[model samples]
Target: MPPAANRPRAVAIELNAVLVALIGDEPQVLTLENGALLPSGPFEGDHPTLQTGLRAWVERQTHHPLGYVEQLYTFADRSRAAATLGRRIVSISYLGLTRERAAAGEHEPGWQSWYRYFPWEDWRGGTPAVLSRQLLPRLRRWIDAAANAMTKRERRQRVEVNFADATWNEDLVLQRYELLYEAGLVPEAAARRPIADPLPGAPMHYDHRRILATGIARLRAKIKYRPVVFELMPPDFTLGQLQLAVEALAGRPLHKQNFRRLIDQQGLVEETGAVSAETGGRPARLYRFRREIVIERAVAGSKLPLSRSS
Candidate 1:
């Protein structure tokens, strides 16, 4: 038998919350009172399954039932928290999708703009002015400070990929933040001193911002191959709302004519004979996602052509 000291110890189960809601044209995440993230509590030997536990946790806190739920990942990093003394606590993270309901006037889950946590991710107005104005210069200085040739090359590669002259790759959003963390460039890594004046985006209590980046990256990639974009849409929507959802995920505007053409060609949606007056012109027709395609293809996805201007 293996020595007792080498054997793995049983850890209490911990659940992490990743509550996302759409605001205007972007997602806002929920946070708690403590500096610690607003993740769910321990399984507490109460849950029969992870999903059941998640549903309960969300409803009890937000009073809004979750519409779509998916397990994100498990985290148990030693540096994550000072909990459990020296023991590493395993945290199961989940990506929960739901439309926000008005607060019942009681339980307060503070809503913060998701963009505040990820300023660089927004490009709906063409690369946030902040990136070109602030982040890039600091990043360049960090790049230039690399001591060796190989390190410099890696830094430049990160720069090129994260904030490249090439079209922004929506899928690499999380990877970009992680790369920054690893390079000791982000606020999370600069634990001891003030690195720069204000970071282009807001920082979270703990690793919540990083977790948000993970969700953004996952959704960006998922939308390309999984038809999950429908989760954020109304039961009926105008093509403009559809485009906005896609642009929100892609972080860039799509060509209007081409987007309509592609949606028509793919037959991913059907007109519902309903009209929305929200756009301030002739009422736009409403469309519903083709549920059949979602079931038949299961993982099928529609494409949104992205360019720098798109």
Candidate 2:
């Protein structure tokens, strides 16, 4: 057996949740601390499991019940140690999907748009002006300030590939946020440098923003191979409504015809023999997700083809 001095010490565990919902085509996340942080609390010794502890705290903090919850990631970075006052703290985070619900009373934390903390991630209309007008130039300066030519080149390459000049990859949410943090262009990175403007997006307390990024990236990737997005939708929806919800989450414009074709090919949804008069142009057919696919299929994919610029 090893000596007592060589044994590793135990660390405190924490539970954080990135609960997501969509309101009128805008993707939002439940937040606490006056929208400055995600709902989180330390894991108590009496709690039977990590998930139960998480659910308890989330319900207590937000007064909202979670649905379709899944583990997002565990973070134990050295920077996070400050929050525990030199003790090691491990944050186990979860991603949850649900429809927007009204608060029972006025005192709740309430849902805030996710884009408030990630403005550059959204591209449903087109590239966010903040990217070209502010972020890209700052990123270029950051790359140029690298210690060596090779480092500069590598940084530039990563930026290009992740941002994809004319075309954007919605799945790179976490990568983009980390790049900004390293460059000290975000408010959260102000401790590293004297930030001037600090970009447009709001900053969260501690590493909550980074955790949120992880959830966003995970959801973007999962939607391509799973029908999880249905958790955020109503019982009956039109093809246009479904496409809008996807575009809102993906932060890009999707080709309408291609999107409908992909959904039809997968047979993931079925018409309800109803039409929605809410649609402006004409009454559109309503459809409901086919839950049986969960048992019958091995894996299903939701293909979202991007719309080309005119």
Instruction: Highest lDDT: give the candidate number.
Output: 2
Which residue pairs clash within candidate 1?
A: 17-39, 253-310
Candidate 2 Cα misplacement greater than 4 A, ranges: 1-10, 81-84, 102-104, 296-298
What's the lDDT of the predicted structure labeled candidate 2? 0.87
lDDT of 1: 0.74
How many clashes in candidate 1?
A: 2
* Leading candidate by TM-score: 2
- The digit string of per-residue lDDT tens for model 2 on 1-310 reads 8785565656788899999998988899998877898999999988898888998999898878888899999998867735446467899999999885746466888688999999998887677889999999988888989999999999999889887657578899999999889889999998777888888999998899999999999999888888888999999999999999988898888887889889989898999999999998889999999989776554555566767531
- lDDT of all the models against the reference? 0.74, 0.87
Q: Tell me which residue pairs clash in candidate 2.
A: none
TM-score of each: 0.88, 0.93
The residue ranges of model 1 lying beyond 4 angstroms of the native Cα positions read 1-10, 34-36, 104-106, 192-198, 299-301
Clashes of each: 2, 0
